[model samples]
Target: KNKYALQLDLVKDLEEAEARLAEVEQKLDPVGDYVEASMIAAASAQFHNVVAQLRILNPNVEFVEDGLDEDKE
Candidate 1:
């Protein structure tokens, strides 16, 4: 029973962390045009790193790819 409670607590912590991350992303979204692109690129790189770590930690989980082009040969 204690292990189950710990697991639930960990899941809650993960959810809160994700929410805080989204809040940070929202705050960063409204910068002026001159810096927005660079900021977004940096943020994307950081997000990718986090995702890679998550994948390593949860090897059984699969991630879906987006924006694949069919025309490219």
Candidate 2:
């Protein structure tokens, strides 16, 4: 009974914390956020291209990222 009560209290606390985080995230700096997102996107594309080129250069080698095959399984 005490354990169940503690679990319920913890869940309620987590719900409150998540609500606060959502409220704070809603107040982000718009221009900074957009610029940061764009930079991340550019970097991701460049990384993807490099990985593709590496695959082409070593066709027989099955890399961990060959088909983004690391964490899928």
Candidate 3:
């Protein structure tokens, strides 16, 4: 009987711990999403900035699709 009671108490504690972990994860999900979004936004801005710098450095360069043909090379 004592063993069964101890086991029940342990099970209850485990359940409470799991519930708390779940709540904490739920709270952190939005923060994770915001960080991910921020990284993506920063990367996009950097890419555009690089493109702009490249254009300034080579204003006369024409952008052609598929680039130079291998046969022409």
The Cα local distance difference test for each model comes to 0.75, 0.78, 0.75
Best by TM-score: 2
Please provide, for model 1 over 1-73, each residue's C-alpha lDDT reduced to its tens digit, 9 standing for 90 to 100.
6999999999999999999987887677655564665767787777778878989998999976453312234
Which pairs of residues clash in candidate 1, taking residues 3 or more apart in a chain or in different chains?
A: none
Tens digits of lDDT, candidate 2, 1-73 = 6999999999999999999887776677534686677777787788789889999999999868555523232
Model 3 scores a TM of 0.45
- Residue pairs that clash (backbone atoms under 3 angstroms), model 3: none
Q: How would you encode candidate 3's per-residue C-alpha lDDT over 1-66 as one tens digit per residue?
A: 699999999999999999998788779884578767777778767766776788889899865435
lDDT of model 1, residue 19 = 100
Kindly report which residue stretches of model 1 are placed more than 4 angstroms away from their true locations once superposed.
Answer: 1-32, 65-73
Which model, 2 or 3, shows the larger lDDT? 2
Error of 1 at 57 (Å): 0.4
RMSD versus native structure for model 2:
9.0
